[model samples]
Target: MKVLEKQARTVDEAVQLALEELGVSRDEVEVEVIDEGNKGILSFLSKPTKVKVTVKPKPEEVAVGFLNGLLHFIDKNAKVKCLPEDEILKLEIESEDAGILIGKRGSTLDALQYLTSLVVNKNCEEFVRIVLDAENYREKREDTLEHLALKIADKVKETKKSIMLEPMYPNERRIIHTTLQKDRKIVTKSVGKEPYRRVIISLK
Candidate 1:
């Protein structure tokens, strides 16, 4: 669970403002109005009340939770110890046989990661992005993706021809789009169908 705090002149305003900033709705948050500004008499000016708001993490957990669960299962089923680390609700699991959780092509691992993040973020009233990783796989993949984005951007610039990149997951595609979007001489666009879709980088 995450705790997000904010202040506003009124309870409604505090909630509304927090909701906007947190990307959450009224139902997602439990609000506490800590203070109302002071109102002074005659010679003094009235000050708007200050409010303190704390937002708690939602109950919903994501796919990563399932991976963590699976890790537990493996530990119990195979007698391997699964250690868990919760960094601000971002769960990282370390086990003796972490490879089993990773699975082939990291598919099982990805599924678990995806679910855990989904559940945690959905239930989290605050904008807490839950990241679950086992054996540093996600970190390595992220590094690779970052390098690939840079490589592709360089290629697009060198060739001076619109380059079509391999289809990628939404996150990967986002990385590509973000990496090249700032280039003054080029523009990026996503084309093709889902699963087989790809991004196009063209000279603008």
Candidate 2:
């Protein structure tokens, strides 16, 4: 949300000035006429109109602002780019210090994503899914997970023994489960609780 107060000769003029300053259309903002100018005698004695203009809440903008501040706070000269669509907002972090933001196995990235999602959804009428990624980290990690699933499936079949993978986040487990679902000869199941949940691959 962004707000500006402007004083002009009329309410409409004040609103127009505010809109121009905010860089948004009239319909995109909520305007409140604080004081309608009074032409006491002639235009020389008139009082100026005052109004407050607020840009409606926009989730993508809020997310970008929050992420940029957070990045700067962490002493990183990163850039935030937004790709917005219906029900989803994707933010990409570009910087030379990508490794720090990504953290081990993308834990830092995931944490930042969670915090950003919370900020974006605050006071919003609808929930929007947020995805934060650095250097296409999510896609690269997904590819790696898919490959791991296939390799482990092959190993399980070759050794004729069930294999339990290290605990993985829910989405990671989902990738493993979905990738192996087509293999009728191989079965995948997730066991244990979240943050410690492990995926099991064995003979069906």
Candidate 3:
């Protein structure tokens, strides 16, 4: 993508010149005026206009570039080999005794993945959906969540009431809600505040 600007007698003329220079149609470029031309008493004596023109990339290219950067960063800094799948990216990191990356209950790894996603989205000219995981961590996490949901749902059935599960991030909560969506005897709902919010399972 490239941006170009120039001053001309009128906004329309300025945009036209930009399109000509960019070798693109008028619809392909975005034009914004930094300074509108001042029209004098005589039409021929109008002040020059200043406008900015930008060219954008196609959505697919943007998504590829974003994933490329993510792969590079993981390989260079984390010393991990990452491969981009059709809809997700996978990483392999050697197991360490300290397990610093996993943090407390894999919080650090989760935070790293989130930050990587932010960087990819920031650099791309178009929106791209990226999912990062280490050694199928997301799949394992999903299974764990399903088990927990079933356990809580059983408790709810036995007690004939609701059971409040500990707070989780939006993604984790979604997993819980989705995993139990088909169960006719149990229902899931979110409660409390963000960062401290939790999921409640009740008998349906």
lDDT of each: 0.64, 0.92, 0.73
Q: Give model 3's TM-score versus the native structure.
A: 0.59
Writing each residue's lDDT as its tens digit, candidate 2 over 1-204 gives 699999998889899999898899987888888888796898689899999999987888889999999999874689999987766799999988899999998999999999999999986777889999999999999999999999999999999999999989888899999999999899999899878999999999
List, residue by residue over 158-178, the lDDT tens digit for candidate 1.
Answer: 988778887776767787778
Q: List runs of model 2 lying over 4 Å from the truth.
A: 1-53
The positional error of residue 146 in candidate 3, measured at the CA in angstroms, is 0.6
Report the Cα lDDT for candidate 2: 0.92
* Model 3, span 1-204: residue lDDT tens: 889997888899998889889899876677889999788999778789999999765433444455446545444334454565675555544333225555665676677666666765675555555555555567787899989998888888888989898888788999999989999998899999998999999987
Q: Where does model 3 exceed 4 Å of error?
A: 1-78, 90-92, 95-98
Better of 2 and 3 by lDDT: 2
Residue 27 lDDT, candidate 1, scale 0-100: 70
- As for candidate 2, its clashing pairs are none
Model 1 gets an lDDT of 0.64
Model 1: residues >4 Å from true position, as ranges? 1-68, 72-88, 97-100, 103-106, 118-128
